[model samples]
Target: MNRLFDKSIVLACCIAAALGLAVDARLVAAFCLGVVVASLAEIAQGERARRASEAASYAYIMVAVFAPSFAPFAPLALYDIARRVRREHVWGALGAGAIFVCALVAYAHAGALPARALLLTAILSVAATLLSLRTAQLEREQERMRRTRDELQERALVLEARNRDLADRQDYEVELATLAERARIAREIHDNVGHQLTRASLQAEALRVVHADEPGVAADFTDVKRTVDEALQLVRASVHALNDNATDLSVQLERIVEDARSDGGPQIELEVLAEHAPANIANCFAAILREALSNTMRHTRAQNVIVRCMEHPSFYQLVVSDDGTGAAKTNSRGIAEGMGLGSMRERVEALGGTFTAGPRAGAPGWRVFATVPKQQGDDAR
Candidate 1:
């Protein structure tokens, strides 16, 4: 923009120089010459506004450039130049000539020397003013263009930042899930294969003691066979869980609750605010509720549990409350607890949703609220 304005201002001054040095009629003709360039520029732009306006602009510019000696018309001509043409050759020529004509008239009447001096001073003053206005306009336009470019650049930066933030958050979620799955795998190894191997080792030692002499290997073989069989069952169960994520959220929650009960972990009373929900949302709610209840059993002493799963067309809400005790009494999300409900909160939040857990209002228990985005829930489903 600055370059464009500079070039235009220089062009204006060059045209003005030709006019000041020329004879009067020729000065007018030279100032009017830019009509050809303006018309061609308008044609190249294919801008109807410029093309439609060519005639009026040309007339105004020509008048502004040549009307000085034709004065009282000069100022009107300048105004018309700005209004009709917006810009043209007249500002320098006519403006300079007006002053030159007056100064020359006065010097000659008063009998001052050679007409040359008056013409030089008057022409210089007009030339200086025209170039001055041109430069000022250029500066203002440059600043405006700079501001617009900066604004567009700022918007692009903001979008890129948001995109990066979303991608980082997604990567973090995938990492967390892998870690959780690995931990479950470790637990499986401990519970199934580890125990079986230990039992087999013990039985082998017993067989070693009992049959110090004959076919002792038979007993050890029997124990090894039994342990391997049990290990196979455990492996199959883990595979089933991995493949069957299509189960409804409520069913998963019930399974978790029943498992906790069987383990004699904790007694929890669960309630559903909706009998059936959109199957998609129903899953995360189920997970969130299950995790909340798991934390209640593992971490809290409060007994009574009430889980409300609310459904709507566009969104869903879950409130898992446990009378086990308050947050003030125990931490649901401390590093000491490692990967439990805190991890659950992180999981829910990653789905572009909200998860809040704290002490229940007016109740001495912890309340867990998890709301997953409907859009993400649909994808999950």
Candidate 2:
């Protein structure tokens, strides 16, 4: 709307300039020449230049007042003056009003206009003043609204970031609580149940010493001692498994292989390419190793077993291979005959890991391989 008003004013100036060409051509030429010069000079560069341009515009208005047709352009100057002049300045306000009144008086006297024409001109001029004031007010309101919208958008972004930080903190706290509980359970089992198993094994040894003269009774005492010793080893292994820690992974794997070899199960070979791993990766590696070895011993009368562990920048891997009679194929996974293999697969894949177990191609043996991520921050889900 503001742009349209400016264009209308420019159009009025051109029409007035053309109409003045016939009535009193010499006076009309002087007025048109002044208006053109003032309009051209209005395109000022700086503060000093703008003040000079304003002075020239006022001079052109005084000269153009003689022609009744050039009356519409008078409001353009009044609008500019109203904006720059404060209301408290009485003299400035009166000066602008006097210039507008003089232009109306000169226009009314110069031409043989009717009384109705004079009244109409007065109404139009007053309406132009009100329109200029309204346009300025509208511009201020628009600027205020734009600033309000920008502030709202910035506040929303800040709130979203704060919410994300709160969620991350909550997850961290829950993970800490879970790890603490597991360690506490492992400690209780080692302190209470382990002590009873050790005492029982010692009692059986003393019984065999006391019955040294009787061969049959001594043999029974020897068997009881051996069984107690085996139970103690099993209990220790279980406690170690419960207390899952990253740095303890290599040590636990070694113990598992040693126990199997000493029990006349298989000639086992172990290789660890990387020892350092995150807690989740280390736990998964230990679980897969235990399950695979158990399956090889129970299902296949394997003569030899091989286990390998490797660590990469982002993940850890485990491979267990046994040279024995491979299990027969069924509907589910080849190793799904027992719950251990299925459980191990679920554990590995739960942490964005992969697990596979099957008979080795072109070989009379079975192999189990798995890879788990070093950082499974989201848990099983």
What lDDT tens digits, residue by residue, belong to model 2 across residues 24-99?
A: 6554555465445435444567878766765655655564465554444444454444444546764765675677
List per-prediction Cα lDDT, in the order shown.
0.56, 0.67
Candidate 1 lDDT, 223-332, residue by residue in tens: 66666657656665554444333334555555556556644455566655554454545556766766777677767776577767766666667888877754545644
lDDT of 1: 0.56
Model 1 misses residue 372 by how many Å? 1.4
**True lDDT of residue 74, candidate 1:** 27
RMSD of each: 17.9, 19.0
Off by over 4 Å in 2: 1-69, 83-94, 110-121, 208-381
TM-score against native, each model: 0.32, 0.49
Q: Give residue 381's lDDT in candidate 1 (0 to 100).
A: 31
